[model samples]
Target chain A: MVKQKSLRTLVAAATAALLLPASANAETVKIGVVMTFSGGAANFGKQIGQGMELFMQEHPEAFGGHTVELIKRDAKHPGGDVAKAAVRELITREKVDMLAGFVFSPNAIASAELVTQGKVPMVVMNAGTAWITKLSPYIARVSFTMWQSGHPMGTYAKETLGCETAAVGYTDYPPGKDSLNAFQTGFEAAGGKVVDAIPMGGPREVPDFTPFFQRVKDAAPDCLYVFVPSGNHAGAVTKTFADLGMRDAGIQLIGPGDITQDTELQGMGDDAVGLVTMHHYSADYDTPQNQAFVSAWKAAYGADSTPDFMAVAGWDGMAAIAHVVKTLDGEIDADAAMEALAGWTFESPRGPIMIDPETRDIVHDEHVHEVVKDGDRLKIKVIDSIAQVKDPCKALKIGKCGE
Target chain B: MADATRARERATAHVVTAHRWRWVEAAPWLVATGAFFLLPDYMTLGTQIVITVMFALSLDLILGFAGIITLGHAAYFGVGAYACGMLSAHLGWTEPVSALFAATLVAAFVGWLSGLVLMRYHGLTLLMLTLSVAILLQQLANTYSDFTGGFDGLTGIYFDPVFGVFEYDLWSHTHYWYALAWLAVVFVVARRIVYSPFGRSLVGIRENALRMHAVGAPVFRRQVAVYTVSAGIAGLSGALFAQANTFVTLDVLGFTRSGIIMIILILGGTGRLYGAFVGAIVYMVLEDELSKLTPEFWEFGVGLALVLVVLFARNGILGLLDRARSLLAERGR
Candidate 1:
C-alpha cells in the first residue's frame, strides 16, 4: 500500500514539473499572488484569489490593452521563510509586475522584506496587522486593519447605542488580542467603562463555551462584546451564547462582526438574531454599489449568498488595482500606482471607500449591523454607519499610526 | 554449535563488506557541499532541505534503530525552535552555535522526563501520550502570548555573522553552510551511536522487549536514553531552522509537522540514517516546487508518492538504490 502510494505521488509530482507553465512574458502584466492556499487561514487567501479571478473575468481588459495573468504561489507555511522565498521566486523567476494576496499577517510581515528588496509594488488584500503597511514604500493595503473594523463598534456601542458599561470576551490569540484591545481603546476613549474583560485562553476547538458565557452573564453589563474568528465555527459562538440564555436576559450581544460572519449567520438560524456586530462588509448593506456586487457575485456563485469579508476584501483589492491600471494606460508604475490609489475612491459592496496612501489602509464607512432573523433565515441589516473612519491605529495612544 | 558458528561467520562477512564501502556514507554531505558551491541561487531551498534532513535523521534514530514509535516527535522540535527563538529575541543570545547547543540540551532534558512516563506503554496509548504532550506544549506556548509572540510568531530574531566575520547576506548562503556543517556533525555523532553495542541492544529490545529484559539488557533505561538522544538531535535541527529563518511559529510544533517527518523517514526507509538524506531532498524539493503549480492539490501528489514508495519499495529509496547498484554490477559482469 505504501509503495503504491509512493509511486503515485512521484508520478503526480513529475507531472506537475512537466506542467510548469512558462514564466511571465515580458509584454503582459503579471500579478504574483503569494498566499496560503493550504493552512489554518486558507479561506482568507482563497476568497481574495477568487475575487481577483472573478474581476479578471468580468473585465478581460483590466490592465488597459495588456494581457494580465495572475500567478498564484502558496506560502505553504506562513513561517516568514516560505513567504519570502515565494515572493522572491515570483519577482525574479516569474518576472511579475505586481504582487498581491496576503491573508496571514506574519506572512505579510515576512513578504514585506522582499517587497522592499525586490522593489515590487505589492498590494495587500487582507492582513490586519497594524504595522504591515509600514513595511515598504512599494507596499499598499486594500483591506481594513483589525483596529479599523473593531474600533467603530466600541464607539457605536458607547455613543450611539447608549451603552455605558460593557463586557468584552475574546480568544487569546494575536487577532483576538488586537480586536479586544481596539474595542477597549475605542470604548474607553468614548467615555465608556469596561465592567468585565475576559479572554478565552488555550486553543480554538473548545467543546464548551458554557463556563465563559456564565462569567459574562454574571457581570450583567449593558452590552456583551465578543471576538471570535470568521468561518464555519463563527456561528457556534452565538449559538453558545444563545444556549446560555444571555440574549433573553437583555444584555444585547455585540461583537467584532466576525462572530456573525456573512456566510455563517444564515446557518445559525435565530440564534444570532438581534446580534449587533461591525465589520468591513455586510452584504445586506443596501447601496447601488452593493446591489451590483451582490447581484453579480450571487449570479455567478448562486442566489443563496452572503459575501464573506474575505471575498469583499478580494473584490475591493482587484477593483482598486484595476482603477490604477486604467489611469496608467497599460504601464505598472510603482509611484504612479501609489499616487493614483491614494485618493482613489471606489464603490465597494460595503460602501464608498478611499485608499489612504500615507498609511496604505482603506478609509471606509464602518457598517454597524444587526443580525435580524428575516422570517426563517438570518441576515445582516445595516442599522447605522460610522462615516469615513480612518485606520484605528490613530485611536491607539502609541500604536503604529498613532501620535 | 556448528550452526551458531556459521551464523557468526556470516555476520563477520557482512561487517567486512559494509566497512569496505563505508566511504559511501560521506556521499550526501559531499553532494550537499558541491550543491552549496554550484547552486548559489538555490541556497534558501538548500537550507530548508538540510534542516528537514537533520530533523528526519533524528527520527531515524528512535523509530528506525531503537524502534520507538512516536506521533509527536515535533514536540522536541518545537521546543528547540522556541527555545532558540526566545533566547535570540528576548535574551539577546544572537550567537547561533551556542544557542542551538543549549536548546538541544533543554529539549533532551524534556525528552528524558517525558520518556520516564512514555517508556511504560507500547502501542496506541503510547501514541496518544506523545500526541497529548505535544498538544500541551503547543497550547502553553500559545496561551502565554507575551513571551511566545502567540500566532504572530517569533519575529525579528537574527543570528550574528559566523565568527563575526562572515556577514549575513542576501542569498542566505551563510545559513546554508552553517546548517550543512551542523548536519554533518550531527550525522557523524548519530553514526557513532548507532554502530555501537548499545545500538544493537536497542534493536534487540525493539524486536522483543521481554527477552531483552530477561537477558539483563535494562530495556527501559536503554529506550529512554535513545529517546533522549533522538530528541536532542531533533531539537538541534529545529534550532538550526529557527536560526536560518530568524522566525519561529506554533506550526513548528504542530501535529502535521510530526506526521510529515515520520512519512519522510518511512519513505526513505527506516533503520537507515542515510535514508533521511535521500527522503528529505525528494520530499522537500517536490513540495516546494510543485506547490507553486497546484497550490490546492499538491498534497495529493505528495500523498500518492508516499503510498507508492511504501507499497512497492518497502525498504524505501535507499533500498531501491541498493537493488539498482547490485543489478548494475550483475549486468556489468
Candidate 2:
C-alpha cells in the first residue's frame, strides 16, 4: 500500500510539472485581420499581407516577449455586411485581442460598433475615409485620407503648376465627394476657382468619360482634377484624357496620386507622363529606407509585383501594432493599446509619420510627384514636398469631421 | 345513409389532418429557441441567420410556390432597407414596427409596378429584366450619395425599443429575438397561404401555366399578386436587417444577395415550406464554421457541398430524408 501511494504521488507531481509550462507562459496575442481577399480589389489584400509579413520578419522585437498569432478572415466585398459579420465572429468566437486590415471605407465604418463593443483596438491599414477614426475611439489609422493628398495637390496645382482654374470629376461616392471637397477648398483658398464639378457614375463599374470630359473641355478649365477609386479606373481615366486630347488643348491633367496609382501607371504608358499629382508614398521614392523596403518586398514577393501606397499603409499599420504590443508588454488592454498609438511617431518607408492625437488620423509628408518615362517604364519623380501635412478635413473642422 | 355519413366523416378527417400542426414542425422552432440559451456568444450571427431565413422564406413564396423565376428579388429587399433606413435617419420614424410596415408597403407598391412589366415576360427575358431593375436601383442609390450614403453606407440610423419595450443591446440579444418573432408571424402566414386554394393554383401555374389559364385561373393576376406579397415579406425582412444592423449598404440590392437566397432555397429543397428554415440554418452554420477553419479557401468547401447535394440529394437534404423514409417503409411492408 505504501509503495502504491508513492507511485501515485510521483504521477501527480509529473502531471503538474507538465501543466506548469503551459500555464506560466500565457502571453499570446491574436490579431484578427479583416480584408477583401477576393473579388476585383483582391490585390489590396495580397499587397497588405506582403507588407505585414515583411514588417514582422524584419522587426521581431516589435512584439516584445509575446507570441503573436494572426487570424485572417476574408471580407470578400466592400458592402459592409460581410465585413461586419466577419468582425462579429472574430470578436465573439475567436476572441482576438486586436483587429486590423480594412481596405474599404464602408467595411471599416461598419466594423466601428463591433470594435467599440468588443473593446478591441483596430488599426486601419488602407481605408482612407477621413471620419473613420472618429467613429470609434478604439480605431486608429495608418493610411492617409483623401484630403491628405487632394488638398495638397490643389495647393500645388495653383501655386506651382500655375493653373488658375480647375474642374473636378469624381466617382459619385463618399470618398469621391471627400476628394472633391478637399481639392475645391484648397484651390479656392489658394485663389484658384473650381469651374465645374461632375459626378461621374458610381464606383462599381468604370463609366465612359467621353461626355463628361467633353463637358469639362468645353468649360476650358486651366487644369482638370479627377478622382476615381484606384486600379482599372485610373487606367481608363488616363486613356480617356489622352483620347480626348485634353493635354494638347492646354488643360493640364492634375489630381491626387489615385489618378496614377503605381499598379495601373505602367498600363497607362505615355499617356500618364507629365501628369503631376501629390501623394504620400510612391514605389519610385528614392529614400534609403524606401529602397531597403522595396528590395525586401521584391525579395519576398517577386520582381514583377510592385508595392503601392496600400502596401506601405499595411506595413506601417503593423509597425504601429507592434509598438503597442511592446509598450503594453503583451498584457494588451484595449485602452492602453489605443493610448500607445495616439501621438505615436515612427519613421516609415514613406518618411516620418505620426498619429495625430487630436483626431487619431495619420500625419505625414505629401510629396508632389510628376510621372516621368524612364527606359520605357513610368516612374514618379518627387518635385516638391509638403512636410507634415495633417488631414485638412479634421484640422479645418469640415462638415462631418466637426461632429 | 351509412355510406353518406362515412364519406362526410372521411372528408372532415382529411381537413383536420391538413391543418394539424405536426410535432416535427415544432422541432425547428424549439431548436431555434434553444440556441438563445446555448449560443449566447453567437447572438450577432444568430440574428443574421434568422434575418436570412426570413428573407429566404419570402423568396420561396414566389420562386418555390408560385414558380416565378426572379434573379433580382433583392430589389424589394433593398427598397425596404432604404425606406426604413431613410425614414429613421431623415424622417424621424424611430418606431421599428411602424417603419417596417411602411417599408413593406413601399416595397409591395414597387413590386406591383414592376410586376406589370416583369410578369408579362418569362424565362431568360424575365431574368434579365429583374437583374436590370436591381442594378438600376443600386446605381440610383450610388448616384444620390446625400440620401443613400452612396456605398459609404447609411449612417445615423436609430431605432426605438421594439414594441416600446426591448431595446437593441450590444450583445444583439434583442435583435435576434425581434427577428425571430417576425419570422414566426411570417412563417404562419406563409404556411396558411401555401396550403390554401390560391397557393394550389400557384403550384398549378408553375406546373403548367397554359393549363392553369385554360381553367380560368387568371395566371398573370395570380403571378402579380403572389409576387407583390413575396416582395412585401422580403421588405419586412430587409427592414428587420436594417434595424438590427442600424446600417445599409448598396449590397442590399446587389446580385450576390439575390443569388444567395436562391441558393439557400435550392439547398433546402425548394417548394418545401420548411426548406428555407433548414437551408438557412445549414448554410449559415457551414459558412460560419468553414470560414473559421479555412479563411482563404472556405468558399471551396461550400461549393463542394453544393455540388454534392445537387448530385446525390436532388431534392435537397429533406428529399434525401424522404427517400430514406420511403425505403424503410417498403422494407417493413
Candidate 3:
C-alpha cells in the first residue's frame, strides 16, 4: 500500500511537470520580431531592437503574469517578396501574440497584411509609409508617418525660416513619394513654391553624387530639401553636396526626419551644422521620461550609440503592447487589445500620444529642429512644435485611412 | 546450338541498347514535371516553386547545357521587374501584355549589353563582371529613385486580368496557377532546346570548349545566344513575380536576391529542371517552419541543413532518392 501511494505521487508530479507552460522554465512572453538585421537598414532595426530590449530589461515581468521574450529575424536588404514571406512565417507559424519591428516601409507593409490576415494586433515602430494606418485595422503605428514630419518641416520652412523657393530631392519609393507629396501640400498651403523635385531611388552606395548635386544646384532654390535614409547613403550624399560647394550656392540643406536621426551626417562636420529637420523625440528633449529613456538606453547600448527616432518609437510601442497585455492578463486577444488601444493615450518619452479612434492614427506633435554642436557631439535643438496634425491618408483618400 | 546462342546474344544487345536509351531519355524529365506541378497546395509555396523552376530553366541553358557561369543573373530579373512595374504604373497596360513586353525587350536589351562585357571574359572574370553589373544596376535603381521608386518600391499597383481571364488578387491563388502554366510552357521549351542541334553544340562546349571551338562551333555566339535566352526567361519570372504580388521593390536587384536564386538552384540540383522546382519548394517550406520555431535562429538550422546536404549527399535530395531506389533494386536482386 505504501509503495503504490509513492508511485502514484511520482506519476502525478511528472504529469504536472509535463503540463507546465514553457514560460515556467524561462517565463517570458515570446515576441517574434522581423527586422533588417543584416542589411543597409540594419542600423535602424538594431536601434529599435536595442530600445525594446532596454524596456524589457527595465520592466521585466511587467506584463500581467509573464516575462517577455523577443525573437529577432534579420530581413536582409532588398528582401522583396522574401520579406513578405518571412512575415507570414513569423505570424502564422510562430503564433506570436503580437508583431513588431520593421524599419523599412515595404517590410512593414507586407508584415501589416499578414498581421491583419492572422487577426493579430501589431504596433509598428518605424517605417512610416502612411499605408500602415491607411490599409489595415490590425496595425497601430507608434512612429510618425513621412507626411507627419514632412508637412511640419514645410510649415517651418515657410513660417519660421521665411524660405520662398525650395528644391526637393528624395528617394522615389512609397515613403519618399509620400514625404515629398506631403511637403508639397504643406509648403504650397503656406504660400511657398517648390522649384524642382528630384526623386532618387534609395540604398545608394556610390562614390559620386556630382550629377545629382549639379541638378539641385541648377534649380537655384533658396533651400534644398533632401530625404535620404540609411547612414552610408547619407554620408555619400552629404560628402558630395559638401564637395560641390553647394552651401555657397545659397541652398541651405533641409531634410525630413531621417536627416537628424542618421549618425553618418555627423561626419559631414560643419556642413551639417545649419541643417534643419522635422521629427519627433530629439535627444535634446528635456523631460524626465525622455531623460530616463536616454540614460537607460545609453547605459545599456553605450554612450556612443545615440538613439534614433525609430528607437524611441520602438520603446513606446513595447510599452503600449505591455499596457494592453497587462490589462488583458497577458492574453492578447486581437479585438480586446485593439479596443484597448483605440483612443488609448499614453505618456511616452515623446510627450503624449493620443490614438485617434476615428482615423486609427496616432495624432501627435511634430517638432522642427536644427542641428547644433553640443561640445563634440551633434544634437538637435527643437525650435518649434507642430501640434495635432491630421492623418494624411484621411486627407488624401488613399487606402482605408478613414476607417 | 551455336545459332541459338547468337540469337540470344542479339536479343541481349537489343535489350541493353533500349535500357541505355531509357536511362538517357525523356521519361525521368516527364515524371519530374508532373510531380512538380502536382505538389504544393499553398499559393505562396506553389508560386515560389514555379518562379524558381523558371529561373533554373533559364540558368540551365547557360550553365548546365552551355559553358557559362553567371553570378549576376538578378540584373536582368531586376530590369524586367522595374520595366514591367514602370509600364503598368504609368501606361496602365494589362498585366500579361506588360509582363511579356518587359520580359522580352528589357531583359533582352540588358542581356545583350551585359553580354558584350560578359563575352569578353571567361570563368572568374566573367563571374566578377556579372556581379559588378548587378551591383551597378541596383545602385542606379536606388540613386535614380524618380523612376524606380527607391527602397520603398512602387506599391499599390493593380494588374488587369490575364488575357481577360484569371484576375490577379492579393491572396495570390490565381497568380499561382498562372505562374504554374507559364512554368510548364517554359519547361517544354527548355526540353525542346535541350534536344536541338544548338543544345548539342552547347553540351559539346560544356564538355570541352576548346575542342568545340576547334570544330568551328562559333563558341562565343552560342554562349551569347544562350545567355540572352536565359536572361529573357529570368526576366519573365521577375515580371510574373511583380505582377503576381502587385508590388516591386528595389531589392530585386540586390546581390542577396541573386545569391538566393543560386542557392535554390544548388539545393534543387543544378542542370535539372525539376531540381529548381523541388529545391524552391523545400527551401521555402523549411524557412516557413523554422521561422516559426525561432525567428532569429532559424537561419542556423537552414545553414546546418545545407552543410549536411553538401557533405553527405552530392546530388541533393533527388539524387539521394535515386540512389535509394537503385539500392532497393540491388537488394531485390
TM-score of each: 0.90, 0.92, 0.76
Candidate 3 lDDT, B58-113, residue by residue in tens: 87678777868878888888888877877877677756765666666889888977
The RMSD of every model to the true structure, in order and in angstroms, is 5.7, 6.8, 8.1
Flag clash pairs in model 2.
Answer: none
TM-score computed on alpha carbons, candidate 2: 0.92
lDDT of 1 by residue, A322-355 (tens): 7776677657877777888787888777778888
State the displacement of the C-alpha of residue A185, model 2, in Å, after optimal TM-score superposition: 1.6
CAPRI verdict (incorrect, acceptable, medium, high) for model 2: acceptable
Please provide, for model 2 over A117-226, each residue's C-alpha lDDT reduced to its tens digit, 9 standing for 90 to 100. Answer: 88999999999888999999999999989999888888888988999999999988877889999999999999999999999977878999999999999999999999
The DockQ figures for the candidates are: 0.31, 0.44, 0.24
lDDT of 1 at A251: 84
Q: Taking the tens digit of each residue's C-alpha lDDT, what string does model 3 give over A1-403?
A: 1223211111111222245552344223456666775534557776787777677666644454455556566665544476666665556455678877777777776556566777878777877777566657887878878878887778778888888999888775566777788888778889899989986754354435677779889888877888876465566666678888888888788878676664554665665677778877777788898889888888987887777677888788878777776677666788888888888877778778877786567777787778788888676788888777766656666543444
User: Which regions of candidate 3 deviate over 4 angstroms?
Assistant: A1-31, A60-62, A66-71, A172-174, A199-201, A206-220, A235-251, A262-270, A327-331, A396-403, B1-50, B75-151, B154-192, B207-229, B239-246, B263-333
For every model in order, the TM-score on chain A comes to 0.88, 0.92, 0.86
| Segments of candidate 2 deviating more than 4 angstroms | A1-26, B1-16, B330-333
True contacts kept of each: 0.41, 0.47, 0.26
What's the true lDDT of residue A312 in model 1? 83
Give the least accurate 10-residue stretch of model 2 chain A, judged by summed lDDT. A5-14
Q: Which candidate would rank higher by lDDT, 1 or 2?
A: 2
